[model samples]
Target: MDKIRRWVQEGGTLITLKNASEWAIKQGIVKEKLLIPANGGWADTTATRAASTAPASEGKKTKETASASTPGSRRTDFVNQEHEGTRAIAGSIYRTDVDLTNPIAFGLTDRRLYVFRNGTTFLRPSRNPYATVAQYTATPLVSGYVSKANLKQISNSAAIVVSKVGAGRVVLFADDPNFRHYWHGTARLFTNALLLGPLLNLPEGPATISAEEE
Candidate 1:
């Protein structure tokens, strides 16, 4: 992880997915948490599930911190939120917003992009200038069997998160675009990240942007 941090400080881009997203966010690279169902069927632990539905607290605190333990001596701060998960939501078609202007979003056409199994995390307010390159607009349903009650509690979250860590770029995905070598709609996104990720613009300033995962 330290080596990875060094690469990023040297202007390298780290593209992470699924459980990897959980790791990066926890390390402060992405500023969010990748959540998964505590059990195979349920979305998350009871506490996280409930907190996921509660409205964003107006009084939530935002703080900043600086650390030079790493290579570039990056300083960052952002509000973090506890998030829940939907049953993987595989095989279901969902539309997410795409920022065409962002280089990381290059090659994607149409105002929206169709994807399968967007199990990524969401962001809360933060000082990091991260951007939501793509986000879910509607409640997501489990691919085969999910309760309406569960879906109703789902929050429209970022399907794709882009930010600069030190001199490098990081792209966080809810789930792997290449889940099983069958889902192809979002493969371009992964490709774009590999090709254009390093060139991704750094956040101009602090902006609103997730949680600890087991």
Candidate 2:
């Protein structure tokens, strides 16, 4: 975020797309002409059944830190105090290690894939696009291409609550068949908005334009 903030302040543009539209525009990924289509509504699978589960990419476990014993009830603030000062000043502190014996996998043997988080397995058909968000929420089915866990949320073709993404702001965009176009624009807009805060110095400047094109 800090680095991204600096870039946006200096006049940087973030680009994103769905359906791999931009991916299609480039070579290698799509061997042929790839024209992204308009988005179709979510698909429904009420009668479908849940299929499988997959573990989120594991975070590596660090050596246990013995908690400090207290008089009444022992309380530890290890996770809080450990990375206090340098967390922001330093670069990203990404770690992935699951001290577990086996990582879980959740998915179905279908064309689409759904991803989820908060760590739990699903028992529904998650994919196959629907015509409306109403029909999409009628039942749970695991079916779309999910990444970063929480597969069903974004992958859901039906009624999806996108409130939790990017500071809990609900952004409504018209659908384009490729859907990727919206996400790409959304993701870029978000990155632009956030990084621009410090970069554009909105708190201290005259006026700064956000990702809003108009």
Number of the top lDDT candidate: 1
lDDT of 2 by residue, 137-200 (tens): 3223343322332233323222211111122222111122223344332233234333432222
lDDT of each: 0.60, 0.24
Best by TM-score: 1
Q: Write the per-residue lDDT of candidate 1 for residues 1-214, one digit (tens) a residue.
A: 6788889878888888866765676665554444344433333222433343445662132111213233235534433212223333434566666778777677767767766764434332223434667766675443454445434334465677776677777787766788777878788788888988767775566543223222
Residue pairs in collision within model 1: 78-126, 81-210, 119-174, 120-174, 123-209, 124-209, 126-208, 126-209, 127-206
List per-candidate RMSD values in Å.
13.6, 22.4
Clashes of 2: 47
**Clash numbers, per candidate:** 9, 47
Error of 1 at 146 (Å): 3.2
Query: Model 2 RMSD to the real structure?
Result: 22.4
